[model samples]
Target: MRRIMLLLILYSSKASFSYWSRQMNGIRVSGWLVSCSYSHFTTSCH
Candidate 1:
């Protein structure tokens, strides 16, 4: 019983970690894109 519980906890924690990492990556990508776009816009305006 203890082994099964440990396995379950490990499995769920890994799953959550992957999900959190992917979410953080998405936010970083979006931020980078916004900055790139803003710079492009400023250059074009000038």
Candidate 2:
């Protein structure tokens, strides 16, 4: 019974960690893309 509880706690923590990491990675990628495009636009206009 104690082992099962431990497993459940570990699984939940791992799942939440992965979910948050994925969200952060997505935000980073989108921010990078936006910055790249903005820079390209500015360079082209000059």
Candidate 3:
């Protein structure tokens, strides 16, 4: 029982870490898109 519980904890921690990594990647891509869009807008305006 104790071993099962330890395994569960380790698995959950890794799952959460992967989830956070994916979220970070999404945020980085969105930020880059936003900057590119802003630059395009300014260039078009001028």
lDDT of each: 0.89, 0.89, 0.88
lDDT, candidate 1, 1-46, per-residue tens: 9999999999999999989999999999998888888988777522
Cα lDDT for residue 3, model 1? 100
TM-score of each: 0.58, 0.59, 0.59
RMSD of 1: 4.1
Q: Which stretches of candidate 3 lie over 4 Å from their true place?
A: 1-11, 43-46
Clashes of 1: 0
lDDT for each residue of candidate 2 in 1-46, tens digit (9 for 90 to 100): 9999999999999989989899999999999888888988777522
Candidate 3 structure quality by residue, lDDT tens digits, 1-46: 9999999999999989989999999999999888888988777522
Which scores greater on TM-score, model 1 or model 2?
2
RMSD of each: 4.1, 4.3, 4.3
Question: Over all chains combined, what TM-score does candidate 1 have?
Answer: 0.58
Looking at model 3, report the run of 10 residues with the lowest lDDT sum. Answer: 37-46
User: Following a full C-alpha superposition, what root-mean-square deviation does model 2 have from the true structure?
Assistant: 4.3
